[model samples]
Target: MPTPTKTGKRTSGLPAKTRLQWSGLSLAIALFLFPIILPISGLDGPQSRMLGIFLAAICLWVTEAIPLTATAVGVIFLEVVLISDAAIVPVGADATSAKVYFASLANPVLILFLGGFMIADGAAKYGLDKNLAALLLRPFGGSARLTLLGLMSITALLSAFMSNTATTAAMFAVVSPILKALPTRRARAGVALAIPVAANLGGIATPVGSPPNAIAIGALAEKQIYLTFAGWIALSLPIVLVLLLFSWGVLSTVALPVGTQLELEMKVDFDRSRAAIWFYLITALTIALWLTESLHGVASTIVGFFPVVAFLATQVMDGEDLKKISWPVLWLVAGGIALGVGVGATELDKWLLGSINWQSFSVLWLLLLLALVAVGMSNVISNSASANLLVPLTLGLGASISVDQGTVAVVIAIACSLAMCLPISTPPNAIAYATGTITNRAMLLMGLVVGILGIILLAFVMPFYWYGVGLLPVN
Candidate 1:
């Protein structure tokens, strides 16, 4: 019913596109609908329905196929309105309990953890993060590899207690200046890419390092399998160290030939000695608190509060800068937590378990499939959402295959953080991409290489170590 425009062009009520683009869209649409047409050959009921919703959500997320927040709301609406029948309900009548549905939003631990992000934001605004980076990189000004190590180490250390996005943003601010000082374009590009890659890689070191870790930990605890700080470290640290080394090797081998090293021009105006002492003391105390949680019977959330209070009281950051925090991210995480809890509380997990044909697949094979699916899904969706959707599925798969459910669940959790392939893949990648130092092609190539390496490392090494350390029971 559309009319022609003033120029005599037809208005089909569709966005303008070239013929080739239209052809591609047509092909994509066909491919998308292929599964739906062949009903008998398609996925089982719960899985088919869930996959349809998940794919739709992912398409919207990846292509801006729609507004992101709107898509998230759409997911909730679809689940509540379209899929709320007895067959599709997650917790059944109990799942709809106001207490469980809104639990994540009201969770005290989650709120306290959200406050940590505000502290990090405050640190970034006041230039404290820059000061810290400068102090760390000053000694390594003459050596490229040492500079890389310093940056990686500092990022890893910071990520242990702060969000990876906050750490990447903070480190990017400091590293950008150093990159500009470099004489060669190649060196600038290489360091720019490496900084974010390091930040993302470092995030696997701690439970608080990324949302996926937090969700996995929380989900497991819901099942009554509590992971202690020491237990998490035992399972994760080796994976972190090995992956760090692998990443270093890859980046080092692909080094850009340096033409000239820049003179260290930045002056240290901040009291490095005092800041270093306070930072270390606070860091040590925080770690101690996490490690001794079983003895104190105190939650990590309660322990995390002390550092924020100390950081504020010591004038490390002003109260006003705290407003810069990503309140939306906090909300997003809370929403995800609530959604995940709802899924578990309902019969959704059990339904998924009942529907899968696990007798046809081996445990190792299933785990590999999950790893690949997770990495691919994360590339399109938020890593948190990817983990949230996949964790229940993985847990369900594990039970069907007779594998240790906790181990399989944790593996998927850690693997979800392995999104390194694109700008939108993870926040650290976005921050790095924003610098304009590296090309999208270069970032993708590097991320592809590193991502594969990470998967191989996690797939083989993590399970063995987890079982050996007693964090996971032998199956």
Candidate 2:
């Protein structure tokens, strides 16, 4: 219906090729009709209907039939319009139960990320990320391997408390030029690929590091299983440190040919402007508050907004800066939260969870199974969607199994965070793919290996590390 572009290509077309379209549409239709035509899989009318909706949501999310946010919104609309009476309605009648879906728009996890987006946008706009990256990368001066490690370290350190996607983009901006200055493309690939992986790994270190972590916390909070900011750092920081080192080797050896090295250079113009100084001070204060949240009993979600207040009050970030906030990402997270809410309200999650035979598997085995499924699902769909779909069900399953639900919650979060195999897997992977330095084959192969390694580490190492952090009972 639209005119062709000046370049002679159609401006509007199907989002995917015909084959993909056929496959996706067929799958989506099949899922929609599945519950009606077949056995209910032992589910009742409401549970069967919920399963159909869940499958439809998964199909839409996976197929690119529409935008993910649209799919999420459609889920809420369908719930309210056609299936309201089936929802929990613990607080109100069928008509008002729709409020449950809308309530997630203001979910605490969404608020934290909303505030985080503003801070990250300000940091990027003011060149705070660059200034900081220059300082950190300069110390390794001249050794490509060390510089690569340094870049990953800084990226991980920042992502531990910030947005992984923002951190990956910022780090790529800072490091791409240095990599380009090298003799060949092979050398550039080393740090380019490693930065995103590190960003992903770093996000596991703190609750605020990644959305999945926040989702896990929010779901567990319903059951009174709490994990402090410090507690999360204790549980995940070691794994992050190991992954950073291991992934650096993989990029340097497997992704890039051995003997590839760059004389990396990081130069700083050293901006000491009032705004820059304020940026540094407020950022530091924010990190301190997030890290020490337990001591003050202030929720991190409450502390997250401090940056918005500090930056605006000091005029470090102006109205224009506010315009760049990741509003779409907030919407996306909100939609995912709302989907989780819908699952809870329908009791679909509880019914499925209760149906599982939990007595057969030990706690460690249960942890591994959940992690595997989370990682697998995240690879195919958006990680936030993966978390929303799985965490509530996982929490219910964990409690039913009589295991420490908090421990299972952490494992699931880590598994979701490590899904980096494809561009569709996570925002960081997509950002790295945009660099044009890595190939689909390279990313898929390397990401698969790294994802496996991370899962293995999580399975074997988490129990001991968790025990040390007091999140797990001594075996």
Error of 2 at 118 (Å): 1.1
lDDT of each: 0.66, 0.75
Cα lDDT tens digits, model 1, 1-475, are: 8888999988887656556545544554554455445553334443344444555554554545443555455555544533344334442343344544445554544544554565456455545666777787777766676677677778876776677888888787677667877666767877788877778777777776777776677667656777765567668788777767777666655664443444454455564566545755675677688788888988776776777777667765556656666555555555455445545544445665676687787656666777888888888678877776677556655556767877876777778887788998998888888888878888888878877876776666667667786788636
Question: Tens digit of lDDT per residue, candidate 2, span 354-374?
Answer: 766888887777777788898
In angstroms, what RMSD does candidate 1 have relative to the true structure?
A: 6.7
lDDT of 1: 0.66
Cα displacement (Å) at residue 82, model 1 = 9.2
**Candidate 2 — worst ten consecutive residues by lDDT sum?**
87-96
